[model samples]
Target: MAVVCSKGDWFVSSCSSTLVSVNLKQTCEPFVFDCAKAEKRPKETEGNNKSSEGGSKEKDSDRILGFAVSSSGKHIALTDDHKRLVLFCTEPTWQCISTRWVVRRGTSLVFTQAEDEVFVADKSGDVYSFSVLEPQKPGELKLGHVSMLLAVALSPDDKYIITADRDEKIRVSFRQAPYNIQAFCLGHREFVSTLLVPTGHPDWLLSGSGDGTMKIWHYETGRRLQSVDVRQHGILQNSDADTEKRFAVSRIISSPDGRHIAVQCEQFPSVQIFLVNSGIESCLNHAETLALPQAPWDMTFDSQNQLWLLLESEDINVLLYRHSEQHWKLCDTETPELKRVTEALQAQANVYKGSVGLESQFKHLYKVTFDNMASYLQKKQERLEQQSKKRAANSSKHNVGGKKCKKESSPVAQSTS
Candidate 1:
């Protein structure tokens, strides 16, 4: 629910409808923007989903469902549970630029490489594009799939729009002419949860799914280069049987240089690292796993290529990791920038309830397995028992018939003697 993302000098996250921003390169207090407290802009035309008259108050379900930060760190956009697409400008300072309505709830959002438009993917399997230059304009329908879209991304060159759905399919379509299909990356056995197009690798695309595996792909051709089963690393060990069954790849992020990849499961306490080796035949080598005391809700790489972790803890909510000597070392969270962000979040309105201990989003989404072998064996045993009973009855009938004939013959022999 509470996922964090960063680009350029800004690391922003959303708690329900309210967005929290922390300037990574500056020592300024964090800023919070609540959609409920802001004024709604007038709609240009009536939408299929009715808009409340006079900017009716936000509903209980109006939490920030999806959010994205521009590559330049100058803009941010978030969609709420209220079917609203809200945009913000952070360069001049955190300010609400526009609030518009969507026909359905948004699941994932991203900006194009040019940062001219923000693409929002909804649970209804539709992709809508909203223009940043025209803030008050409604989103135009792009392309759609038959299943609920779990993740959406744009290629580095902004030529392709990639989308993943519950049907375990990754589609690469022309961004402008979405009707023209390019390729399909089809290997996952379960619902896809996240998609990533690494920064330095223009042709490479990475994806994670409920199947507990991550795959490397060439976006244009849909060729799978390598597939890594994260379960092999034992990053999902737990005593709870149910929790283990629900494990899936929740997030996948990579460094700006495309040398390291961090893959995280839904509620696991550890993160898996994979080293991407490029050569004549490039492949992924499992690097290591970093265990934490608590499960992290999200992980992201800033422009500096360092990892920032958002944890579900009371004492501290964020941690920084620096790469040194081929290992990630925990940096002290006492830096002025981090301290200001933490303090500001703690001091802000009592809305810092981390998305922990809530009902998991993947509970019902996990594939259900049936014990077909067990049932098959039981039916075979029953059939054999019935056949044995029939054979025994036939044998007893034959034995009784022979005994009657023998008794009749003995009586005849006695009479003759």
Candidate 2:
């Protein structure tokens, strides 16, 4: 199930390459943008032809990779599997602002604090900056990493750009001068999946990883403030449960106020909330562990600071939680706005029910580890044997050739005698 996010009155979600944005205010109809139906722009088509033949494969399957809304909630941007970045304006009404091509498929999208530029991190370990004002302008390369970048986020001050990669590293770089490395938040045993610079806590950075841990850092200096073992917080898994997934943090989001942090594992039915006790020396204090009736496919906190959960079940597809008086209380499921949003997203109910993606999505991301020493020794032995066989064959060929040459010389000598 695609993650659900909200911007002001707009509650947006994506399925496949299609984006569905509904106005909870009920003034605007549920707006849908399907990349499949998008007509090729002459300029974009011409530019596509100019691209090197060594570009991303034409999967013909255009699916939304990730999307983000600006902090002001005035703009929303998304990248699709077809190497296209689409932006939408959410002012008076939802309208397509721009559709541009990225150098490669984007893994994450983030808007700078200025909201004038959108930064896209791709599988090639590079980040690109696209202009929000100049819709027709092409993207410019910002920075590069040695390994594939999984997530990218901007500092609240827009001075630093934080990036996470498949190489199990989080890099903090100067946005204006990317070459000037700020610090490296190291220690995640596995690839990091999400990065967030919490609201109000400008210097603090939170990251969730495949290692099933959440690490907080003083992003500028790269000093780790705290590392939380998320797996340990929840119930112990049975012997047969997958070790990596029982605790891997697939998603971590902070409330707009940055007072609460929500962590979830993919397809897991429980969400853990941690209270941020912010000060000069701040850390995460465990608040509550919520066990849901059905495994939530995705969830997000709205602009109003209310949590919205999209579950795997279709009958009760949505749940809302309001934090009142220091307690999270469940809201009525029969709200009018929720009904409209659900009706617009009814087509994706079956897709959400499909457990294949939910269960196996993060499973493939974890690097499969084996004994490299054993493998190396085995390969070395095979190479030595192959060399020995080649040497024997070469020696036999040389001997045969020598013998034949000697016999021909002997026949010539006998004829001369």
Candidate 3:
């Protein structure tokens, strides 16, 4: 369980998959359990020699593919590779409060703003919503997509759920009463890779596609507002001399203010940010570039509006983009204290059966470190921008004086002649 958040607290699950939880309000110590070497020891209880449910937990029962926390940060909803939906309450401890098998092979999980429930999308092209607690059978919503559902997103108001599929279609559904299928956003000619709802705008939804286009649309009205074709920007020109340029939209994200949109494309060699609503617009507003060694899987913006990008490869690496500084900074994942904690938790996970002790610890540490680094870099970028403006002003003044000297010399030379 690798936990990621705005704050750098991370947890690694028994399966070595990490979930980093950012945006944690407080620091909490974690318990690490190493499943590889862990053994279950049962103690007789008062009820007819019964054992504690916690002690009798099963190891490797679930493998999480994607997970998300509620807006309140009290509830966590996760989707395992087996397409099971599991919700947990994080206040007391990491306990499985509820488990509802929503999809036969679930690929993604998205939570509403209220945190009362989550929407699970499956590989077989089925979507279902289940309550966070109490009620069992989930309300089923059968979706027909040409291919698998690739990405899912919830609106800011949580009134609508937007899903993108491999067939390059986006479906918007109302979350409440009617629970009606609102509209199908059709534009991309290839598989859709990601979907995003710009911060503070509940009405706007953005989609990125393998067709190399980043499209912004009005969720409620199903109107195509704007389309940004990345390949036309000339940033990903094929340098093979004879080979043609091939680019696919890897990820698309909008800034917190909704004033800028960022796009990450395959083989593009960098990330690009575009100024939205600005008259000076380009497909790729080459503000900054990140020469990533691998393809980026996902990107999220924290409260400070800094972008934390993750790569989903065997060797995972997270990078933070400093927009003001126009550079990409790699996250420091090698702190001695963090390393010690991680190692300890990993060892414990190997020793405990059915225990999520190590996963919780890894999640906490990941959240803390990622959040801290994002905040620090955001401030650093602001300072650097200020310094850059100051230098530019001073340079302009120097150039003006040189021009005045040239004018004064011109009059003297003319008079002498």
Worst ten-residue run, lDDT, model 1?
Answer: 45-54
User: How well is each residue in 1-417 modelled by candidate 2, as lDDT tens digits?
Assistant: 476788777888876667888888775568888877764546766466347436545654577889998877789999877778888888776788888887677899999889999999998899999999897799998899988899999999899999999989999999999989999999999989899888778989999998888999999999999999887765354354555444568788889887899988766677888999965555898888777876677788877788888877746377778888888888775677777787778855554444324445566677887899999999999999999999999999999999988987896778988
| Cα-based TM-score, every candidate | 0.83, 0.83, 0.62
**Alpha-carbon deviation at 322 in model 1, angstroms:** 0.4
lDDT of 3 by residue, 155-243 (tens): 88777778888777898887674247888899988777778886655677878877678887887878887787776554545353223
- Residue 20 error, candidate 2, Å: 1.3
Q: Which one is best on lDDT?
A: 1
Model 3 stretches with alpha carbons more than 4 Å out: 1-62, 133-139, 142-147, 177-179, 232-235, 238-247, 255-260, 266-269, 278-286, 311-316, 325-417
- Whichever of 2 and 3 has more TM-score, that candidate is 2
Over 1-417, each residue of candidate 1 has an lDDT whose tens digit, in order, gives 577888877878777567888887777767788877765534454333545234445353657788998888888998877677889898777888988887777889999989899999988799999999999898899999998998999998889999999889999999999999999999999999999987678898999999889999997999999888887675535444353465689999989888899999877788888887877566678887888888888889888778888776655477778889989988787866566656766664355465457777777776678799998999999999999999999999999999988987896777988
Query: Candidate 3, residue 333: CA error in Å?
Result: 7.7
Best by TM-score: 1
Ranking by TM-score: 1, 2, 3
**lDDT to native, each model:** 0.82, 0.81, 0.58
